[model samples]
Target: MNRIWIPMAAAMIALIGAAQASAHESLWIEAEHLDGVRGYCWPMGRPKMKTTAGHWGLSGPGWAAEWNMGGESGFLSIATGADDDKAVATKTLEIPTAGRYFVWVRYGDWREQTERFQIQIQQAGGQPWTARYGERAIVEEDNEMKLYWDWVFAWDRHEVELQKGPARLSLASTTKERSPRQVDVIVLTTDPSYRPRIKERPGNHAWEILQSYRDGIPDGLEPLAKNRPNFNLPSQWKVRTFRNKDFLYLWNVSHTKPEETWLGDKPDRVKVPYNIIDKETREEFEKTYGGRDDVPIFSDPRIVPTFHGVGAGIFTTDPKTGELLEAGKRFAAWLDADPNRNWAMMMNYHPGKPIGEKGIQAFRKYRDRFVGSISGESLGYFYPDAKAMQQATA
Candidate 1:
């Protein structure tokens, strides 16, 4: 009876060990940790990489917050700038006791911009299998579109089968020259019910390494820390809402220098669906989109008229002469001459230099047209004499 009891107890211990091993079958592959093969970009170039402390609810050392603008930390960026450009990131995934592993990749799908990507897996002596994804409708919640990183399962084409060894896993872009798509991490799990939560899971070696790298930074090479946006403005001025009559802003339309090419012709720079037109280019623009009301420029709910912001030296003194540029005067006349040009034209300024008494007086003539200096949102901080400048505009 004692021998039988001892054997039963040993069997119970073996069963518990098997259960524990099966419970920990999931393996996390950090996207940034993967080896970049081609057309891959470092996180240092984008605010998402520089600002996010730790993505997916994971944070530790090396996770220094630069601007705290909110984005993923240690994420991989796949560039898509040219027709022939292709981005690929690969890593060897270790399978503990793999039979069939579900591959999950976390990525940002802001406005369905990052909808084209592929997840490929290859086991030893086996041909590679690709699970392709394509454009998906934007997921919306609470009357707003979602723009955060979410997980997608690689199960469209085939189930990923792996042996209990190393398997080559890759993420590749399938778009023809566009914005970069960011990938945060990948998870390979044998448990059918396992789904990644919002926070970081245990056993993230890449996260650990990032912390160590941050801890080892020398004295002055550290990145400059920046405070987040100040949302503490007055209640009425807190939110700037766009009205129906508001137009999309465009600058440098009045550059008289022939050497400075006009950016209005560039589709990338002038991203509106309608071709920009004024008194000079009206006939040319009307030839294409004049009769079509269904075109995006007319049909899109978010479309607005283009606001031409003409730059003049008086808004900020001329670099050499400290006098109002003749070109600025000409643009103001051009904008005023045509009764049809009432769609929001303004004077653009640099404001990096002090607007002397002369410049300030010149600005008073058309103060209503000036929309804070081209420094944009930092006008309060970057623009010298904020109160004086505001009073002049007011």
Candidate 2:
């Protein structure tokens, strides 16, 4: 059983507020939201830093103060050194005007070893400017935990210019010592005297909205973990009733034929579309086991299409002539032909070489027919093509 929690309404409100705010007042960017990460932490082979959401007991933010005080999502953390070390996270933002901006970083000062890191600012297409920001000492909080793990004024002595148009900001690991460092948010402001208040944290409003939803409808959108289907294959199903949509995902589609097909393109390379059982096979299986009390209805293999293998597989190609297959198009057309049905799909391109521009274009061509957008596992793996698709659709 699988479930996903998506706070769409609150997230949209936050985005609108940020977009309308004047850049000079102050700009807040959550560390977790920052992109262009280069690291080896996640098993997906990208975003070296680990992301934490909600709360975790025993140490860090919760051990000191209320965890929600930081932001909507928790934070991005990294422990540098050894084979798992070295990570840099960067984000590009549009600078409203050219001027000097004061930089402040909010981080968990739970350990001294992970206290500091290098910060850089660069105008798009220009060389990066580095600053030797001194080590920030923890400010003793007047609380029982006595943990002042929040924003610290960084690069106080230098003028970090905010170039007009797109500019990049980066936070990188500086030491080879393996110690956890948690970063909640990063702020850039034109006012040197500016200080961040807990109430002004990025996700406070979203958090309040989420609380309202929870309080108003206690069981409105609780996880359907136990109600999920088990088709004997790995899959992910996301339900967003507020938007009247369902996102179904399946990957690594393997087939029964081992000796006749191309299986060694990449280790454990799974093919696609082929993983979907034929209509006759599905009907026969259903006839045999459909309504039996021993088997759940959702467990039926034909409920929603799923890919069972993970490797380089042909989405729409013929092995004999390399001609494109029309089965995927036919399936998508069948789904879209019905106006009353609201369905979306998510597909993975792990090792991303299999799905290129053509695959992304096919998704964009059918975007309007679906209620929800396509999603990926890792930003590093599909962000380039995803960005292109988004731009084209926009």
Candidate 3:
């Protein structure tokens, strides 16, 4: 079993405390499993080599490949200038493991915003295959969408398996002059279909929205003239109702950045779907959701979204201190309202950051804390426990 499961499991015990659990087994995929995947990138680059098994870099012709897995950003990034005028270079290698992986590919269109990318992978020494993924329906690109270069900064995942060891991984590209257009980060896992879940939301109403984005919004909801509203206020936010279904999932919409850039609106800063539910709905949601134990609390206010709406249940800040106010009643009320719940846990701050300093405990509404689990979480901005976040803060 992937060791990542330990952290996730710990967080799970911390989240629902002891009753609920996520359907997914692992959080990421194994890099070794990605070998032999067929790939076709647009006009500028090709697959290369990795100095190490988990390390990937440009290998076809030049020494100017930008890699990011262990770089400052800890993401995959690439630089151009590897291909000479004669003919584009092509690089290929055998992947080590076999499992689902996330392939992040981007093209810089600064000079030429027009480019198409073809990426694929396959069993090493076997016919290559391109993993297909579902794109969100309503994509509103932001200013950053124009592209700076090929970035491996994306963590959006796809379902694939690397059963055949020594997989052959290749990235081939053709570009306009000296442009770099590919960078990638590979996360592996045992389950080919494992996808992470989001934090909060109201109902399945968000599902229709996500499905529409993945496929295309249903005709009924499509704007008359093709205008669609963007709601990222929460982050790459998504919403869903679950089995115990106590809380509505507010997941992040991963590809909401440029190509389909939003004329006006910050990607990280988005508006919540306030119109979806109202006060009555909250009461009903609590009634229907019953009670659930397991929502680990965080004392850090940053752990909680600062902005709150009528339907956007949020913690209140101390008018005098300016620091987030403590509020345990809100969560307690939330749990009390739900019939299936019983356990209470300590607050789960965003991994590190002091709990009482700014977490749910900062507010009177979330005072009654419960068991805490700050490790193995990917909620919000992929926070690691205090131990993990310590370096980031440093």
Question: Which predicted model would earn the best TM-score?
Answer: 1
Give the range of the ten consecutive residues with the poorest summed lDDT in model 1.
53-62
lDDT of 1 at 225: 57
Error of 2 at 216 (Å): 25
Off by over 4 Å in 3: 1-72, 82-118, 131-140, 144-158, 174-178, 189-394
lDDT (tens digit, per residue) of candidate 1 on 90-187: 78877788587777665544443445667898887889888865445323422132422222212122357788888888777656424344456677
Candidate 3 per-residue C-alpha lDDT over 117-145 given as tens digits, one digit per residue, 9 for 90 to 100: 33466564567766422122111233233
Q: What's the TM-score of each model vs. the native?
A: 0.38, 0.35, 0.26
Model 3 TM-score, all chains together: 0.26
Q: Using alpha carbons, what is the TM-score of model 2?
A: 0.35
Pairs clashing within candidate 1: 61-211
Give me the runs in candidate 2 sitting further than 4 Å from their true place.
1-25, 37-85, 111-114, 124-127, 132-134, 141-159, 199-394
